[model samples]
Target: MNILPLIVLFPLLGALILAFNPRLPNRLAALVGVGSIGLSALVMVWLNWLFYLGDGGGFTQTLWQWVTVGDFRMGFTLYLDGLSLTMISVITGVGFLIHLFASWYMEKDLEGAPGYARFFAYMNLFVFSMLLLVLGDNLLLLYLGWEGVGLCSYLLIGYYYQSEYNAWCAFKAFIVTRIGDVFLAIGLFLLFTRFGTLDIQQLLQQAPQVWQEGDLMAEVAALMLLGGALGKSAQLPLHTWLADAMAGPTPVSALIHAATMVTAGVYLIARTHTIFELAPFTLSLVALIGLLTLLVAGFTALAQTDIKRVLAYSTMSQIGYMFLALGVQAWDVAIFHLMIHAFFKALLFLTSGSVIIACHHEQNIFKMGGLWRSLKLPYACFLIGGAALSALPLVTAGFYSKDEILWLTFDHGYSLLWLGALLGALLTSIYTFRMIFIVFHGREQIHPHAGRGIAHHLPLLALALLSTFVGGMIHPPLANVLPAGPEGQYGHLIRVLTEVLAAVVALVGVGIAAALFLGRRRLIGNLMEAKEGDRLRRFFYSGFAFDWLYERITVRPFLFIARLHRRDWVNSLVNMWPALALGLNDLLLGTQNGRLRWYAAVMTGGAVSMLFLLLLF
Candidate 1:
C-alpha cells in the first residue's frame, strides 16, 4: 500500500517496456520515458508530504526475504529517512527534468524510432538504478544499484555506436570505474565478514560495539570505500575517465556525470558516517584527497578550450568540496551542497548543450562570441548558473552551502584546509567566468539558432531560479539523521570575516578573469606564447597528463604482457585438458578405421588375450 516502492518501480517498468519495443514511434517513446520519470517525481512529492505528515521519523518496508544461508539473511527491503528523501527527491525530480529536456535535445541528434526508443530505454534504466541506490535498506541492494548505474553509463555514453572514438570512451570509463567498484566490493565483503550482515542500519548499530575507534579493520574498510568514492566521484588519481566521457551526448553528461551519478560518492560517505568516524586517520585522509583534487581540477579547468571539458573539471572540484565537508564532519552541509550543486550544474550543462546545438555542434569556447543577443535564454541561464557555481555572494544558492563548508573547515581547526579551499574557490570563479567571457562576450564567430518548445525552456528556467538564493531556502532535514555541525567557537566577528573573505575571493577571481579574457587581451596571448606558459597549458589541457601516465603504467604494460604470452599462458593451462581429450579421441578414431581383415584380426587377438588372462588367474 505504500508509495515508496512505486518511486523506484515506475522508471524500471518504463525501461522494460521501451526496451521491448525499440521500434516504438518517437512521440510515443517520449511519452513512455518522460512520463515514467514524471510519475516517479510525483510519487516522490506525495511521499515527501506523507513523511512530514507523519511522526517525521524513518520508515522501512520489507517486501520479502530474498536469500538465506548459514547465519546470514537478506531481503528485498527499502529504507526512508530525511537523507534518502533528499536524495530521491533530487534523483526523481531533477532526473525528470533532464529526461524531459533530452526528449527535445535528442530529437535532431537521433533519427528514427529505434534510436529514440533505445535512448529512452537507457535513461529509464539509469533512473531506476539511481533510485534503488538511494532507497535500498541493505548494502547488497545499494551495490546492485551502484553497478547498475555504471553499466547504464557505459551504454548511454556510447549511444553513438557508429563512432569508434565514442565507443572507446565508454570502454575507458567502464574499465576505470570498475577498478573502484572492485574496491567497494572488497569493503562490502570485509564488513560482512566482520559483522555477519550487510543491512546498513544494523552495520551502523553494530560497528561501534564490535570495533574500537581506531581498529585496523575499520580503517581498511573505510579506505577501501574511499577508493570507490574517488573513482565514482572523479576525484584525483581515479579521475582520468570523466573529461573523456564528454564525448557522449550532453544529456548523458548532465544526468550521469553532473547531476546524479557523480554524487554517489558523497552519498556513500554520508550514509556510512558512523564507520568513518571510527577511523580518524582515514577521515583526515578524505579531507586531504578532497583538497588536492579540487586544486588540481581547478587549475585544469582554467586551461580547457572545450566548453564541456571545463565543466567536467569543475564537477571534480565541486565534489572535492563535498568530500572535504565529509572529512571535516559537516555531513549535513555536504549533502546540502550536493543538492544545490545538482541544480546549478545541471543548468550549466543543459545550457551548454543548447549552445552546442545552436552553433551547429561547435563546443569550443574560443570559437563562440557575442551571441548573447541571439541566444538570450541560454546566455541568461549561463550567467545564473555560473554565478552559483562561483558562489557569488548572497544572490546565488552556492554562496550559502559553500560558505558553510568553508566556515566549518576553519571552525574545526583545519585552517590550512580552509585556506586551500579559498584558493580553490578563487580558481573556480576565474575559470568559470573565463569560459563565460570568451564564449559570450567576444565577437560572434558563427550564426546561431536557439532551441524552442516547452522541454527546452521549462527545465532551464526552473533550474535557473533554483540556482539563485531561492533554492537554498528549502532546507534538508538532517537534525536527527546526521550529527550536528561543529559550533563556531570564534564568536560572530570571525564567522562574518570568513564569509566576507570567501565572497571577496570569489569576486576578485571574477575581476581577474574579466581583465584577462575580455577584449582579447594581449597579456593572455603573450603568456600562452611563453615557453613555460605553453608547457603548463599543454599539461593542464591533458588533465595534468594523468591519462598519458596511466597509458604507460597500466595500459601499455598490460598490452605488452598480453603480447608476450602469444595466446596467454593462462589460456594454455585451460586448454590442456581439452587438448588431451581431443588426442584420446583421435586415437580412438584410428582404431575405428578398420578394413574387414583388420576387424577379424582384432577380434581374434581379443579372444586370445581373454583366454590367456583366465589361465594365469
Candidate 2:
C-alpha cells in the first residue's frame, strides 16, 4: 500500500481537528494527539516493510501539479527511499513517544485542557511540517515544510505566552532560523536557474552532467545550502538561539534537539551529497565548522548550570559530529549518528523532564542532588542515556556511530580534524558524566514526588533500551541505503589501535568527571569560586560570548538603525518630494488667482514681447 501520504497526513489531520475544536477535553485531546502520531508511526512501519520487500530505491507519489509556468512545473510529490524512510521512522516513532510523554507532562498545565489541546495541535502541526520536509520530492515543497516547522516552533516555543522570556526565545529561534531559510531559498533559486528542475532526484542527476567538479557556481550554491544547514543544525555562529530555546517545555526541547529541527541540516546535506561533492571546498569547510562548533559547544556545556541548556549545547555538539562525518564523506556514518542521537538525546531530555517535575520545576543541577533514591526510574534512565551520549565504549550506540566518524576521518588522512573530534568526544564524556554526577549523586536538596504515570516511564524505558542496543544493529541496513565510502587502506593493527585510543579518551574523560564532581567536590567548588576560574566559567557559560558579539555586531547596529529611523527618516524623505511640490504650488498660487484680468494682462505682455522680438529679427 502507498502509505507515504498517510504518514504526512495523519498528524496534519489531527492538528486540524484539534485546532477547529478548541474545547476538547484533556483526555480526548491527549488521545487525538498521541493517536495521530501513533497512527503515523504505524504507517511508517508498514512503508518500511514494503520498502524492504521491494527494490531499495526511490518511489515518488505525486499528489498534484502544485505550480506551472510555461516550461516550468513543480509537483506536490512525496519521495520514498531508504534515507527518507529512515528519517520518517525516526520522526514518527520518536515523535509519538514524545507526544505520549507530553500528554502526561502537560496534563496539569496552567491553561488546563484548552492549553493541552492547543499544545497538541501545535505539536501535530510540527510533526506534519517535519514529515513534509523530509518527504517532499521537490525543493519548493521542502521549503514549504521548512517554513512550516519554523512557524510551529515559534508557536510552541512561546506556548507559555505569559512569560516574556519564552516569547523572546521563540522570536529568537524564528528569526535566527529564517536567516538560514533565506539562504536555502536562494540556493533553490540557483538550482532551478541552473538545472531547470526542483525535483531532488532530477537535480542530483542533472548536476553532474552540467557542472564539473569544483565549478564556481556549484561551490556558491553549495555554500548557500550550507548556510541553511548551519543555521538549522545549530552550527557555529548561528547556534545561540538553541540555548535560549530551552525556555520552552522539555518535550519541545527533545523534539527540536533530537529528532526534528536540528537534524534537518544533517538530512539536507545527506540528501544533497551530490552538490556537496561537487564543491570539495565547501565540504572541507563543513568539517571545519563542525570541529569548531563541537569544541565550542562542549566547553559551553561544561559551564552550564541549567540542565536543559547543557543538553542544548550537547545537541549542538552532537550535530557537529554529524557535520564532521558529512565533511569526511561518511554519509552513512552521519545518518547512523543521527539515528543514535535521536534515541539517547530524546531519552535524556524526557528523563530530565521527569527530574524537573520531581524537583518542582527546578532545573539547576547544583540545586539537585542525591535523587537516585527518590527518582530511581529517571536516574537510571538518565544514566543510560548519558552513557550512550558519552559513547561509552562497546556497550552503547554512540560509540559505534561516533567511532565510525573518527575512523573515517583518520582513514581519510585528516589527522587534525580527527584529533579535534577526539577532543570533542572527551569533552562530551566530561560534560555528560558531570551532569549525571551532579544531578543524581550529590545531597538531595528537595523531596520529589514519585507518581509519574506509565506514559512517562514507558517511553523512557523504550528509548533507554534503544540507546543501549540500537547502534550495532542499525549499521548493516543503513549501509545498504547510503553511498558506501572507500575502505581504509590501513593495516588491521592501525585500525585496532585507533579504536582503542578513542575508547581510552572517552574513559579518561569519564575518570576526570567522576573525580571532579564525585570525589573532590570541595576542591572543584573552591576552583569554581576563584577569580580566574569564575571568569573562565563565565566565558564558556556565555557560549564564548558569541551572543554578546552578535549583539554588538549584528543586533546593536540593527537596533541603532531602528532607533535612528524611529520617526521614519526614509519615509520623511519620500514625503519630502511631495512636500516640495506642494510648497512650489503654494508659492505660485498668487499668480493663478482665478482672475480674468490677470490672465488677459499676461497674454497681452507675451504678445507684445513676441512682436518686438520678431521685428528685431
Query: How many Å off is the CA of 110 in candidate 1?
Result: 1.7
Candidate 1 C-alpha error for residue 516, in Å: 0.7
TM-score of each: 0.93, 0.92
Model 1 bad stretches (over 4 Å): 111-114, 485-487, 567-617
Model 1 lDDT per residue over 182-218, tens place: 9999999999989889999999999999989999999
Question: Model 2, 1-617: lDDT tens per residue?
Answer: 57679999999999999999888988899899999999999998899889889877788999998999998888899998888888998999999999999888887444353488888999999999999999998888988998898898899889988899999999999999989989999999999888888899898889999989999999999999999998889998788899998888899889866667899999999999999999999999999999999999999999999999999999999999999999988998899899999999999999998888878889999998899999889988898899888888888988888888999999988899999999999999999999999999978888888636789878998899899866557752455446776567678788889999999999999999999999549878999899999999999988999989988999899999988887797888998999999999998887898999999998999999999999999
State the lDDT at 448 in candidate 2. 86
Q: Score candidate 1 by TM-score against the native.
A: 0.93
How does candidate 2 score on lDDT?
A: 0.89
Which numbered prediction scores highest in lDDT against the true structure? 1
Look at candidate 1 and give me any clashing residue pairs: none
Error of 2 at 524 (Å): 1.2
